[model samples]
Target chain A: MLGRLNHVAIAVRDAEKAAKIYGAAFGAEISAPLPLPEHGVITVFAILPNTKIEFIQPLGETSPIAKFVERNADGGIHHVCYEVPDIVATRDILIAEGARVLGDGEPKIGAHGKPVLFFHPKDFSGALVEIEQS
Target chain B: MLGRLNHVAIAVRDAEKAAKIYGAAFGAEISAPLPLPEHGVITVFAILPNTKIEFIQPLGETSPIAKFVERNADGGIHHVCYEVPDIVATRDILIAEGARVLGDGEPKIGAHGKPVLFFHPKDFSGALVEIEQS
Candidate 1:
């Protein structure tokens, strides 16, 4: 159903600053910072040895990520993404089993050029999880 | 530094039920249910094809995870755990860089016999992250 964890999404106030802080702490350098216009967030990818930690911040106040950070009081884990071989199949199965899809249609290209879709937090406890395929 | 993502921890009100729901939705089976007394939580491991999702529920109301669930108003992604080769070195480095350690002192044996320690969410945004060495 799922593949390896593509990346763990971390919400931050500033992507560049957070990347620098984390890079200094973990002894790793940031890969590249990309702006996700559709999601209304800018993200910096910090590729660790085995896992990639993404630092995300809203581009503007109207961004959904910004709204999420505001609601949570501080930035937190926005979503956990797992790589899946087939996004449509997995999404269909989950929806059939009563899991709600946050996205309206099929999976779309997400950060890192992978197809991704989100499952509502209500369906899987309170964690907003994303399923992606590389 | 890190090996791979051992698992992603999800806090739930009912581990067993959550396991069943996820199992049905993902077409995966519950590997085994384990009781972690020190964390004051019981967990059931749901191994998916490429990733393992852990369902954790507090044994009692006083449990830290229970308190987290309550504070969040619903169960959410509690912590993200990455498998590391050296928990001690990682803990020391993070602490030296002004990261707070939620667990006192050294890493201890966790649910799966791996030594684990938690870094305070304040240091890494708002997500409680656990590092484990198996």
Candidate 2:
């Protein structure tokens, strides 16, 4: 079962710049931009009271979110991640319930260094969803 | 200053139906659909451990999210709501920092019966942001 609403990922052209207002106006703690070449993203986290807002920028030519950023142009909420006690069990239930998992239906190390799997947006009412092992 | 993230609003055609997966798969508590005619929306809340995922359906022809749903076709994140201690003060700070508040630059009673103000997506990395009074 789901544990907590882990984080919301936003795709932007500049992760650190996009998180500036959160720090300057909202007083949220903004983390330094960290580029993960494997994930093809540069992540900047805005630490909120209950959860985190992750600002992600495409890192390379083949970045997965590059197209999303180009299409949105102004950046947008890319996905919402939820924590699960057992991601494998959660994935099994989701698959049994007819939800399509992205990327070979296997869990991969996610941005948070935890096992994570993504569900197809079409299955989740048009919103991209990520489930991470807590 | 900002408080906890109030909720993430996902615009969908069917509020209750869209939240079914959260209840069935994630074991999240799903609330009965509440129609807010004044706000032109019908809402179903999926209660998570740390926050809520609000599924909103347009109630009327003039509903604000009607166009968004039509454009997305598959439902997508409409906006993210964050709580603030003093909305007025927060608004002033955001304005001073060159963030454009949506509409006539005034706070309105939100779906939760709290004062809420929306910011233009252009000012916030193309993602619509809502600030609600805590």
Candidate 3:
């Protein structure tokens, strides 16, 4: 299930440069750079008109985003985040539909102080889908 | 530069099923589906919280989104669309910064009836960025 799009995550090699490119190109204002310790990465949020584009860079070599960049050979579209009213119900529905839940445990505090869970790409075609309750 | 995120485009193998998956899960109302003969694909738009997530399936083999889904071996995040105040100025800035322009010729009417241009992934890392002026 999906709600409104909360944010579109983009994996960038250099968050600063990427932010600049986006800032100059689209006049997106950099809200703040946040450290997502649980995800092992630091991210910058550029607030655009109706949505926020997240610029994510891995803090460590073993970080999942870093590995993804390596696999894709560059930073690309990372994930599409949907704002759901209820995270638990959404997770249950997806799980029942044979979707692979990357986190069956809990919704951790994500970059924007929202509870977020990621669905594995294996279950949802080729895209990593994030469900956030706010 | 950006007015608002017009839509978040997700490449899916089956637009109908993806629409169902998202619809049943998030209670998203499926808007009228549209086909862009110029883009060579049929797409369904599901409007959610405050934004829209587009489920796109290519109509032919030569479509860019079609080729992308094939390269990734699965449907995934296709591109992020940013609404710009002036498409011409935005294009000039990216070009001045050595960004590779995928379509330098002209802005074609995209699926949503807006003039759109695509920026090559080579210039901006691994993501295809589209700019539309409403």
Candidate 4:
């Protein structure tokens, strides 16, 4: 089942400047930038008391974030991650309900170092959904 | 300062169908559809343990949701709402920090019957951020 929301990922061209807004405006603590070559994005976590805002910038031209930015020049909210007790079971449930899981239908290691899987945007009202192991 | 994330609003063509996925897949509780004609959107709240996912559908063509749907076709995550202790103070802080507050720079009575204001997406790394009075 879906647990608490882990974080909302926003795709941006400049993750640092974006993180600065949260840090300066809301006084949120910010994590040092982390690069995930496997995911092809650099992430900075803007920590709030309740949840985090993950700013993701494209690592390379081939990165998905780059493609997303090309389509949405201003960059925008990319995907939302929600915690799940058992990601495998959650994936099964979603599959059974006709939701198309992104990638190879297998959980991959996400930025949080947890097993996570993404659902197709079309099945989620055009909003990409990620379920991460809690 | 920004408090916890209150909810993420998704603009969808059909709020009921969008809410159904959370209900069926995650067994999440869903609120009855409520029409907010003033905002020109019909809304349904999908209750999660940590926060709510708000599904919004356009009540009329003039609605902002309708315009978003026109551009996106399938609809998508429209904006994210974060709770704040003092919206006026938050607005002042954002303005002082060079963030553009959307609309007339005054808090409006939002769907939750609390004062709320939106920050421009361009200023927020492409994600429209709403700060609502807690």
Instruction: Assess candidate 3 and give its lDDT.
Output: 0.77
Candidate 3 lDDT, tens digit per residue, A12-116? 777766777777766678856777777777888888768888888888757778777777666888898888888988888888777788855488877778888
Q: Assign candidate 4 its CAPRI class.
A: high
Candidate 3 C-alpha error for residue A112, in Å: 2.6
Which lDDT tens digits does candidate 1 get at residues A1-134?
Answer: 54566778888887777666457765666866788787688999877655577889888667878777777665788887877788888888888888889858588887667788898888878878788875
Model 2's TM-score against the true structure: 0.98
Q: In candidate 1, which residue pairs clash?
A: A3-A83
Flag regions of model 2 displaced more than 4 Å: none
Give the Å shift of residue B49 in candidate 1.
5.2
Instruction: Please provide, for model 3 over B1-134, each residue's C-alpha lDDT reduced to its tens digit, 9 standing for 90 to 100.
Output: 66788877778777766777676666678865677767877798888767777888887767767777677666787877778878878888878877777855478887778788888876666777888886
Per-residue lDDT of candidate 2, residues A61-133 (tens digit): 9999999999999899999999999999999999988899998988999988999999999999988999999
Ranked candidates, highest DockQ first: 2, 4, 3, 1
Q: Write the per-residue lDDT of candidate 4 for residues B8-100, one digit (tens) a residue.
A: 999988899889989999989999999999989999999888788999999976887777888877779999999999999889989999999
Q: Scoring only chain A, what TM-score does candidate 1 earn?
A: 0.88
Highest-TM-score candidate: 2
Task: Decide which is better by lDDT, 2 or 4.
Answer: 2
Measured against the true structure, the TM-scores of the candidates, in listed sequence, are 0.88, 0.98, 0.91, 0.96
Pick out the ten consecutive residues of candidate 4 chain B with the lowest summed lDDT. B60-69
Q: What is the TM-score of chain B alone in each candidate?
A: 0.87, 0.98, 0.88, 0.97
The residue pairs found clashing in candidate 4 are: none
Residue A35 in candidate 4, Cα distance off native in Å: 1.6
Inter-residue clash pairs, candidate 3: A1-B25, A1-B26, A4-B49
